[model samples]
Target: MSKREMKIKPVIDRTFTDCMEQLQEGYVCAVAATAGCTVEALRRDLFGGDLLITRDGKTAHDQEVSLLLQLKNTTTVRPDPDKETFSYQLKKREYFDRLAAPRKHPKLLLVVMTTSPNQTEWTKGTHDSLEVQYCCYWRSLEGEQAADGVQKPTVRIPTRNVFDAVALTDILDRLDRGEELT
Candidate 1:
């Protein structure tokens, strides 16, 4: 990447904003930890998606394959150990269907973020403080069926769906193979 092309702060900062409540650090951490992965995230109010991540081997400047990310951050404000699965919220069926709508973008990246119930907090005690207990993960929305209602239906994300850098790469690989996210 060239010095002129070193403008990655906006993308990361936007991720931070989208992730502030859910307290998901993966939007910045995992993507940063991974190799060859770059994001072009925006702050759109409506219609357009949040983050645009390039497939592996492509930089933020490259256009080999772009995944439109619809990021959702969930939190367990009231922890429930009896809860079998986390009820993560995606957008309304109509809204999601639109992002999933056919257009110039090839793939829509559905990222489901979640964190421990009320455990993480943004540190304001000092000028430069940070939260330390937030956790998040992702899964593909490729094969899931949409809801028949107008409300933002809750999607159950099993603990098994927790995504690591390898998991993220696999999703990109599936896109490369013309396979929908499984």
Candidate 2:
């Protein structure tokens, strides 16, 4: 048996790890703003992880549904590599496997986000103030399993599977009939 530190050297890269939760929350908020959904950020330790989607404000008066959110962003400080490429180490695959199981009504939805691949910036207001183009993709990991015995798995999220408002709408609609997420 090896010590934890010896087995894994945790690297905290400010470029990516800094304000990470904010990036995910911001993206979800931006998306929900247009889609008429309400998002609630969950506690860090709570398994299944982050964000709960509710019905439109105008529709059910802010009633929540069965949808759990797990966000992954590709926004990093690396200068040359493609911004669309993002790698994440899933610490506890067992927990993920259980969270993504179909037996749960509120399935875990993994959202992968990235800035523009070209690294192009668009004007916000002043010419000096610019922001990178943002995009996101989502997939339901229901019934996904860990490796035969691997504890931590590094997964790569690609750009081609980018999802938009349409996909979000579909997921939200599906949750309407189920139990609300608490």
Candidate lDDT values, in order: 0.54, 0.57
Error of 1 at 19 (Å): 6.5
The candidate that wins on lDDT is: 2
Candidate 2 residue 166 Cα shift, in angstroms, is 2.2
Clashes in model 2: which pairs?
A: none
Candidate 2 segments whose C-alpha is farther than 4 A from its true place: 1-16, 56-64, 75-89, 115-132, 154-161, 177-182
Q: Write the per-residue lDDT of candidate 2 for residues 28-64, one digit (tens) a residue.
A: 7766766776777786736666787765444556656
TM-score of each: 0.61, 0.62
User: Candidate 1: lDDT of 30?
Assistant: 51
Model 1, residue 44: distance off in Å is: 2.0
Residue 41's lDDT in candidate 1: 52
